[model samples]
Target: MTLDLPLIWAGLIAFAVLAYVVLDGFDLGVGILFPLVQGEANKDEMMNSVAPVWDGNETWLVLGGGGLFAVFPLAYSIIMPALYAPIIIMLLALVFRGVAFEFRWKTRRGQFLWDWAFAFGSTVAAFAQGVALGALVQGIKVEGRAYAGGWWDWLTTFSLFTGAALVVGYALLGATWLILKTEDHVQRRAYTIAFWAAPLTLAMIGVVSLWTPFLHPLYVARWFGWPNILLAIPVPLLVLAAAYILLKGLTERRETSPFLAALSLFVLSFIGIGISFYPNIVPHSVTIWDAAAPDNSLSFLLVGAVVLVPLILGYTGYSYWVFRGKVKAVGGYH
Candidate 1:
């Protein structure tokens, strides 16, 4: 089966973005979960669990952003202006989180300050990312490759709602990750958090799913029409099943199942959105075909991409493999 260049590029960038979200999400979740942890020792262990690979996990975000810019310049042009505010905030927050991760263990007297910085920065960064997602799904203002809206146009109620949902979702990922990466009191605490967080995540999913159809006729029709309904049923069904497994794993103290289940839930959410927004690279605006660069440009880019992307993936997998183990709470690697 042959494929259109634009379709191939769109799918590639979409997969890259999904990889970034799932990969970076749990570490950020761990950061956000820090304050909720009762003791300094537990928090240190939680931080240590992510310390080895946090920077590597973030590489996918850069790849995703660069791929979008190269493959779909038109969509990139429109999205940046619409989301510049939140994007800037998100970047700044990430910087804070990254810096805090390094500095928190470096200082003898300033650990308190750095710890707060890490937690706050992670929370804010995650929230801003959700805001950006919300703005995308809630519809951005675009006209002829430009954002045709004011600076505050992205600050819609629906966007805020999405942002809140993402916080809970990331917390769920973080807790599940802890279940896989720690033991004893820390593990139990993470398990308890996962159990509660999953239900909250589900409630948000339910609300977002029900509310989203009303936002656009394309999705409304696609989701409710007969064949689409039958075909689309699997996405939600899988999501629910994953949610059940996640909670059950936490309850039963199954170490890896919670993390794996959370990953499945995230994948299903992305799939649902992908299906609902088919043909649209940016919903209600640019399409894959319309936003794609010239065929020759894409072909040339694909040659380099074919080589570079796999190397990045191999390193990512290897880093995870090398770091695979329960974290020790020796006050983190300073």
Candidate 2:
């Protein structure tokens, strides 16, 4: 039987995106929590907790984007133009956030500026990412293989709500991460933050779940229609289960479980999205087959991806393993 290159590539890209979200998300969440956390030492501990692995966590993002460009050029072409504004903002924010990571250590007098930059960059990056996701889910207007929507088409109430929702979601991730990686006051504050953020994140997830189906008829059919609904039912059930674990972990004062549960919620939500967008790389506008590059190109790229992806995974796992355990309050990996 012939290989289904497009489908394989789609799965690979999806996995990469999920890896990036789960791995890098907590660090970004930490940055978002920077404002709420006081004391230079507390912030230092927060930064130190993620410092060793934060940059490496972004490798999946590069892989996902590059895989899309090489394996699904049509989708990239359409999506880039459609999301140029938000994508650009996300990139800039990431640059600033990255700079803050290093420079914040170098300067004593200007350290506050870097702190603000880190927080601002992380928040904006997270928000832009969510906005881009919302705009895509809401549907990009594609005509004749090109984006036909106006420049401002992405700016909508739904998109704004999703952006805000992501901020809270990231904050939850950050708080849970802090609970896992810090001690004393930082851990206590994280517990307090998680208590509030967990409920808000769940409510936002519920709202977004309800609001998404109305954006397009295809989504309604995929989510609410017959056999598809059977598949769809488990997503929310799993989300509810995850939410319970998250709350229980927080209340019971378990450090690791809350973080794992928060990650599970994101995973469930992602799977729900995948269920909605199966077959269509650009939602209603483009199918995986229609948007894919030539088969020969895919086959060639697959060989490289097969080798590189595993190596990436191996090193990523090793880095985390090496850095595992609570971040000490004093000298650290940063």
| lDDT at 293, model 1 | 95
Candidate 2 lDDT over residue span 65-91, tens digit each: 999999999999999998999999999
lDDT, candidates in the order shown: 0.88, 0.94
147-172 per-residue lDDT for model 1 (tens digits): 79888988999899988898899999
Q: TM-scores of all models? A: 0.96, 0.99
**Candidate 2, position 124, lDDT:** 99
Best-fitting candidate, measured by lDDT?
Answer: 2
Query: What C-alpha lDDT does candidate 2 achieve relative to the native structure?
Result: 0.94
State the TM-score for model 1: 0.96
Candidate number achieving the greatest TM-score relative to the actual structure: 2
